[model samples]
Target: MSIDQVIEQVQAVYGSWGRETTVAQMRADWDRLFGETVSPDSSQPVDADGVCAAWIDAPEIDRDRVLLYFHGGGFQVGSVRSHFDLMHRLSAAARCRVLAVDYRLAPEHIFPAALDDALSAYAWLLEQGVPATNIALAGDSAGGGLALSLLLQLREAGMALPASAAVMSAWTDMTASGESYQTRADSDPIHQRRMVLAMAGNYLGQQDASDPRVSPLFAELQGLPPLLLQVGDRETVLDDSRMFAHKAQAAGVAVQLQVYDAMIHVFQQFPQHLTQAQEAIAAVGQHLEAHWPPHSNPYNS
Candidate 1:
């Protein structure tokens, strides 16, 4: 699809934003928009950690591999509910269950708190007997950055890592120095440079943007699991994925980078209305199935 066509479709669905809106209002709007499109049957009750809201969907063939998902909203919005449809489709396609984490957001919790919640959820999964080999971490936007950051943290802590990870439109660089920031700043549909800067300010209050967890693309990349990155060609943060993939490959990590032409940030949000979005999510499911095969189910042991 051409960039203009994509933008028109997105703008049709989501009109001009209200500058005075809060994250809570955005969350409510998202709920109203996607409530009927998503199947509620897949939802599970929240876990006791008080840091995450999780859901488990059992596949027909019993693939023991689990996908631990983190939703994206620039670290200030989004929840497990916001990503229910994507998670459901992924779970069905991979023939495995998915555990969506509702990590704490920023501007309220700030840096490290979201990271801490993500790590805690992963630890909880491990404690539940989900083998590292049978697990795959996935997310989009800020959540995508978090997934990679979590993998880095796990490696540093000498913990078992997930078999692989799939990240889409990841905002891996808080410094936002990428060439795309200037080149694609005006072309992207959903995100604006000013908005990104504001979100970054909220996420990194009084903290260094250079911190590895806050910016995974700048972190040490060795010893991390195989990774699959799906990025839109028009996103301002396109260079974030580009640089991360380049560095990871140079560091000897297996990486697949799929750059979709003329797409915008997190295109999967329109799976119901856009063929491209459906295709993108299918690609993600395929990548997960390839790296974390159902036969590797540790539950059978």
Candidate 2:
């Protein structure tokens, strides 16, 4: 279907019409829209230090190479199950096992809690003999922001970097300062400025919103590994991706920024009905393959 049609379908399925606003209900809806990968090749739960996580495996996936994923839910709701299908598909497409992290969410677990879980997950991978070169960090929305923050923390700590990273419609600005929030206010069907601001507040708690750790848009982007940044044109956070790309490039980080025209946020997650979504996912696989290469994977043991 065309992008407009895809947007309309997305609106029908996910729009705010009669949608419950409570956290409990929001979570229930998220689960229904994107259910678990019940029949994935394998799904194993794990303990990452104090964090909870799981492995989403697919057939023919490279054993050594792994895609470490963080789920997005405004840092409030979302779990490994909530994003299992996306992780499983990413593994299948990238030909690598996916470690879907169940990072702590906000209100109870605010800023740095989720980031801590992400770092802990990455550290767990390293401690498990998973070479940093064989791993990649990925997430959508808030998770994407966490991925970028984790990279900065890792680099600052002198830790070895992952092979690459991928993010989808990443909400990089905690301040909701992007122009798209205003310009795309009516066109974007998924997000709004006030809502995003509240979500950011929920995640930040007493933390500084402008801190690079909280908002990667304000982060020092130098020395990051290759990245695949995808955002939809119809998204209210469109400027997040656009500004991030320009800054990342200026920081000498190689980035492949894919802006799908007329599409809404996280459109890649709707591959079941959107062909563009599938194609976008395929591009992720190609990007990962180029960086890690097949067969030569560290998991080839």
Candidate 3:
């Protein structure tokens, strides 16, 4: 699909935002547009200092497996509700429960704050006795970046890593040094240089943008778990995923990069309306199912 058509459809569902709006206000507007109850299952509060929200979907018969989902909003917007549909779909596909984290947004919390919350959420899951081998990590956009960042941190902390990870149009490079930043900027529907610059300024504040956690592409990529990256051909962050995939492969990490031609940023958002989006989501589901351990639960059937 053309980028223009995708943007038009998204705009119909999510109205335009002004540059002057605060992060809190933007989040409220997103909640109103996407509706507050995107997740059909009720959320259970996870006991953590930065816990914003969390939801669990258990299989009819329990499996040791689980998926930790992080939503994307440039680290400024999005909530557990914003990504509820995608989480439910992933949970059903993986045939295991999913724990979606509502991590703190940037501009308000800044660097390390979001990362700390994500790490805390994962640590809580570990405390619950979910084995690392049975767990998978997944996210879109900034959250996708966060998934990679979390993996790197976990490795540094000498913790066992998840079985696998799936990232959708991840913004891995906060430095915005990717060639696509210029080449695909005009074609990308949702993201532009101006908006990206604004988001970076808010998130980075006084911190260095080159911090590995802020830009996973710049981090040491060795010893990470297998990674599945889904990106749109026209996304401004296209090179972010591309470069990360290249470096990861060179560092001996099993990595797969799937690029949808002529698509916009995070096309997975319109699964019902766009053929490519549905295909992308289904592809991710298949990858998760294949990598996740076999489930004895009849509910998975």
Best by TM-score: 2
- Model 3 spans with C-alpha error above 4 angstroms: 1-4, 12-15, 36-42, 48-50, 58-63, 296-301
User: What is each predicted model's overall lDDT from 0 to 1?
Assistant: 0.83, 0.85, 0.82
lDDT of 1 at 143: 94
Q: How close to the true structure is residue 85 of candidate 3, measured as C-alpha lDDT?
A: 68
State the displacement of the C-alpha of residue 130, model 1, in Å, after optimal TM-score superposition: 0.8
Q: Residue-wise lDDT of candidate 3 within 1-301, one digit each (tens)?
A: 5557668866754456665766677888766655465545455656554576575664452456778888988898888777776776676666777788888877768888888988998888888888888888999999999999999999999998999999999989888888898999778766877778678778887878778988999999999999999999988999999999999999999999999998887878776568887788778878877786776555751
lDDT of 1 by residue, 1-301 (tens): 5556656755754574577877777667666555545556658866826666676674563447789888888998787677888887888766677889988887788998888888988888888888898889999999999999999999999999999999999989988889998899777876777778788899998888878989998898998888999998889999999999999999999999999887888887767767788888888878887887547443331
Residue 46's lDDT within candidate 2 is 85
- Kindly give the stretch of ten consecutive residues in candidate 1 with the minimal lDDT sum: 292-301
Q: Judging by lDDT against the true structure, name the best candidate.
A: 2
Listed per candidate, the RMSD to the true structure in angstroms reads 2.6, 2.4, 2.4
- Give the deviation of candidate 3 from the true structure as CA RMSD: 2.4
List runs of model 2 lying over 4 Å from the truth.
Answer: 1-21, 36-42, 297-301
For model 3, the local distance difference test gives 0.82
- The TM-score values for the models, in the order shown, are 0.91, 0.92, 0.91
